[model samples]
Target: MPSPPSRVVAVVVTFNRLDQLKVTVARLLDAARTEGLQRVVVIDNASTDGTAAWLDAQTAAQAADGPLVVHRRATNGGGAAGFETGMRLSAEWFDPDWMLVMDDDARPAPGAITAFHASDRTGAMAWAAAVYFPAGGICDMNRPTLNPFWHRGMVTRTLLGMLRGRGRDGFHLTQHDYDARAYRAVDSGSFVGLFVSRAAIETVGYPDGSLFIYGDDVLYSLAMRQAGGQILFDPAIRFEHDFTTMTDADQRFKPLWKTYYHYRNLLLVYRLASGPWFALVLPLMVAKWTLKVRFHSGERGQYLALLGRAIWHGLIRRTQVDHAQVLEWAEPK
Candidate 1:
């Protein structure tokens, strides 16, 4: 008797970036047709732009050749909720052997998914792609790092590196060398091009939907690590990220609301990852936010207010907030 076919599903969370969505989905569908990809699950976060309609048309047009499972949310619960929904529904709908998660702005290079499957044969529970900017530079934020807290030698070396000011990623907890060989072990990775096994998801469960955006991937990857799962970063699995968001140290408050979510979710991530050690991080976080507010010229009062709210909710473990309320808080009075 022949063995059952291996199943792979790509789960994408998209907001209003319709052009990028179109390009990504097209590439994904092309890959699915040729590269043995089984299906794709797109979670649309109630985009005002015509993202939902475009996805609908794609679903209809490509139903036969390249299968797609698109779920349109009623409200914009942000990327965290979208991933939660997409992953859960992908499991229910396809029960895939592997699920590849990415954002709409992320486009997998040729053979990226293939590289993941090839690396998975080495007994990893999850694998992350080597994400790069569209201009071919490494995407700084998506670099996978080893959890020093999980390894004693790593902890000591990390501390020594920090003391020496060796590199920008002194702690060795947030960034990795992009040139690492295939299947380097890691603790976590971003959603940009992460592949998780069915067994791992079954063991650790879905990501917390309430996170509403930032740090969701970190929290989920840490949870997987805590569950005793192995995560590998496959440099051969390359993906390009069209990240146009602010990357500089401007610290201005134009996109003030996202700052709230970023810090709030970061605090929650630290609390969950460190447990009681979070007490050591809380004061540092407070000092950093305070400094940003003091130095930034844009809307200091509003930034302070948002920072306070973020700290309060993060401390209380309240990750979910209504989208409308967040908008109201973000809007200029």
Candidate 2:
């Protein structure tokens, strides 16, 4: 007899994006039966919109065996915290074989989850889907990357590519790789379409909630790799990220306070990526981020101050800074 279908649960972290969350949930529900989706655990990060009301209604309308599970936070804890809670809940409540994690604006393509179950995962502990924009192009930000520090050839190629201005394609998956049928080994990937096995979670634990946002997925996935867990990028399993793109000219943090988390968490990511060579990599990373302040013009002072604080806190591995404190610091003087 054929083996039973794998039990896959989806964890979606949402905050104020009710419309997108609805789409994501609807897609998951639509594929529930066909894809062996046991449950969809949605972590609402204190959304003020009608999200709570909608979720409540959905929960009330569900049967005893309903697949929808909503956990509404009393306070906004950012995506990282939301995922941490969602993943824990998923394992405790649904006991799925694998947990699929994504943002509110992302969802798997039709039959993608089925394809995931059908694929030969082999030695991989986690699998990343080929995330693409709604318009059918590769989502640059969601691409999986190889850790250059882990391999000498990767380090040489990445450094040479950076010197030649080849962008992240040196370290990240190439277009050719995306179009291929086989799974490729990746050191880290975004949360948009990442599927983590229960065994991997038991080994590496959940994502760091203290991160608030940014680099949490990379750090978590890198931790898995560091623990000898292989992560594979499966092009056959596709996901769509319905996110707005920013041009290079308009690529500054919107709230400004976000700069703190972005830079601080990035430091932790670099440290994890470089391992013992973090000290050697620190100056170069800091310099690259520091030079970006020139583009902020009017907010250069505030930007520089945030960068300084981020560097200090990151070096000390401090993630206890309050959100309100970051907001106060970002205020125009």
Which residue runs of candidate 1 sit more than 4 Å off their true CA positions? 1-5, 63-65, 119-122, 153-168, 171-176, 249-254
Each model's C-alpha lDDT?
0.80, 0.89
- Candidate 2 per-residue lDDT over residues 139-194, each given as its tens digit: 98899999889877887787677667674877899899999988899999899999
The 10-residue segment of model 1 with minimum total lDDT is 167-176
Highest TM-score against the true fold, candidate: 2
Give the per-residue lDDT of model 1 (tens digit) for 29-134: 8878777788878899999999988888887786465577789999889999999999999999889988899999998998876665553243877888889999
Strongest candidate by lDDT: 2
lDDT of 2: 0.89
Where does candidate 2 stray beyond 4 Å? none
Query: What TM-score does prediction 2 earn?
Result: 0.96
